[model samples]
Target: MSFPGVRRCHAHRRAPLHAGHRRRTFGGRAGLVLAFALALALGVGGTAAYSALYGSIPTAEAQDRVVVRGGVVRLGTHVYLHANGSHGAIGITRVALVKKCHLRVYLDRQPGDRVVAAVAEEDEAMARLGVQAGISGGIDVVDVRLYRAGRRVCANDRIFGGRSNLWISVTTLARTPRKPATPAPAQPTVPAAPAPPTSSVEPAAAPG
Candidate 1:
């Protein structure tokens, strides 16, 4: 019961665990959990803010209204009305191809007055014959000729001091021509039968 080595072994086995080691392990785990929760909160807040801002943005049609209010350009098919004495330029914002197309201008004018109209490629110089207005005249149909590549392919014009409307129609003249018909083969002709042998017997009887 008094051996020194056995007493030393027994003391080692009863040694107490250090409290600082336990605190270090627990603190590290807690720090990681706190960091994760903070990151998740920030992400959720950012997403909510972005969604609210996106919902407030205007739609395509709404933006078009804003552009129209700014008076930049009328972006639709527009019908303009002018009284008998009104004279000015009318701008058509619709885009169209001039080649192989026809522009028709219908006018109602006073009988005695004449309305001079012209068609050009630009809005400012739209009236190729200068600014002309009708004074006293009846309703008239004015035809504006448009040319493309030195050939008359379309019609466009401007009218002043008249009750009128504009319309466009495409022409079929610009279409490609049909191919020529193939020549028919010549038919073979049959030889006519020789006249039946003249009755030599009849001629002999007449002579007798």
Candidate 2:
């Protein structure tokens, strides 16, 4: 019966919450989502960068080098040959990127059929662009390098003489020319004594 008050809508009422608990809950969930998004973004960005770097994949040829283990490479033994008639050696690209990072290769060419280079046979596009085994223009395309216990091999000075970066050293391994030693100088000769006839004449003049 007293003065009546207007009824309030349920929607207008503030819902109950466990003090700061709701804030913490919301914060935790939001943090998780943000973290996931960040990770995804980083992954995507990384993939994009990689694609851009080696994306311009060339139209590969049917004949290419085979990759073995640990990024070792080898080319067609018959395609790129040495000047001396030796079969072309397998090429080795230290860490060539294939269609994906799924293949492996060993450095040295083993006594068997296998791809020893890091680059895949499917993506051996470099070959089409004049890449091959042997020392082409003073670069070892198919190098025979040496390595340390925990270091990658240097691609220079590995060939018989001056390694080829993308090709073999067609220049055969000739013996380095050794210089001949010169002989010692001869001793000087002594001069002969003066004529005895002059001595006799001079002696007579002195007595007079």
Candidate 3:
């Protein structure tokens, strides 16, 4: 007994209720799944970026030597003393000298590894007060050199030239060791068959 317009209006209202129910059931789950996936991706990406930027920093002891006037003097140095491992950066934090003199510091890397150098001041104070020289990227060997104002000086090699006591301190960031490999499972051992009973009778004297 309802009019045609009223029936149509009732149908339209019921359609919206069914649609809303579907949205509530499926839409929320879909949204949650999408959010979780996004979060996981972001977390993984962040960790990778951090690893790439800063691989690992290694612990090492500092070494020093005296600088004297003579031929060119080269100091062999390393960030990690135990092994020639990978390093991201090397820095000379402080340098102590007995007297003020013109000095130059250089950082040399391996042939294949990335090479980077930190600029040092050209003034003479760099030798006495020390200058910060840092380089980034993987390096195997680092060569350090100390120069007098104009002449190459060898530490402890000459006795007649000006000598300056030098002690240099450095800081570095190096790569860490990889995860240990899992050990293989032990194999089960099989017992050897009992040796055939030794014939103590000597074959009964061969059928005597």
Clashing pairs in 3: 56-174, 68-155
Name the top TM-score candidate. 3
lDDT string, candidate 3, 11-47, tens digits: 4444455654664453576865665566567774544
Candidate 2, after superposition: displacement of residue 118 in Å? 5.2
Please write out the lDDT profile of model 2 over residues 77-139, one tens digit for every residue. 212222334433433334322233211222343343322222222123333333322211212
TM-score of each: 0.20, 0.15, 0.24
lDDT of 3: 0.34
The lowest-lDDT stretch of 10 consecutive residues in candidate 2 is 169-178
The candidate 1 region of ten consecutive residues with least summed lDDT is 67-76
Kindly indicate the candidate among 1 and 2 with the higher TM-score: 1
Q: Pick the candidate with the highest lDDT.
A: 3
Tens digit of per-residue lDDT, candidate 1, span 88-141: 222322333224344323443323432222332223332442432221211243
For candidate 1, give the lDDT.
0.33
Model 3 bad stretches (over 4 Å):
1-47, 50-140, 157-164, 177-208
